[model samples]
Target: MAGLFATLAIRKALDKLSSILPAISLLASSSSAAAMVRQGHEQDLEDLRMLERTMHRIHATLKDAEQHWDIRDESAKLRLKGAQGASV
Candidate 1:
């Protein structure tokens, strides 16, 4: 469930990145594009930076969640084993 949401969020972020890629490519191919970036693309650049930070945070959070889930899963398995042994 957590993984599902994380995957969805990552996909959304990737979609956002795809939208930004053409502008980035333009910068590489055209001096006019470079000038446009210098003159009017500050907001787009800021958005990219913000998305980068969001992705970093998401990655860190997903790592923590995975560790927690692993611990919880192990604990649940042990509890189930203990219950079965008592019943027997």
Candidate 2:
């Protein structure tokens, strides 16, 4: 029963995370696109380009973090199973 509760909690947390992930991604994508649309001279353009790169980097970092969480969650499930097996 405790194990079931723990699994439910983990799944709930992951579901919340999954819901927010797309909003974050869309925000990043839209911001990047907006930066590209803004007018600028050579120097300004360079700066905007840098901003775009930074935004992309941030997006990529978020993606990596989400992937890491997924890996951790999967590992947790495997560990939980192993623990249950031992108990049985």
Number of the top candidate by lDDT?
A: 1
Instruction: Tell me the tens digit of each residue's lDDT in model 2 across 12-71.
Output: 544565565556555555554445443323345455455555444444443444444443
- Can you give the TM-score per candidate against the true fold? 0.44, 0.37
Pairs clashing within candidate 2: none
lDDT scores in order: 0.57, 0.48
- Top candidate on TM-score is 1
lDDT of 2 at 85: 44
After TM-score superposition, the amount by which residue 84's alpha carbon in candidate 2 deviates from its true location, in angstroms, is 9.9
Worst 10 residues of 2 by lDDT: 36-45
Q: Model 1 segments beyond 4 Å from truth?
A: 8-37, 69-88
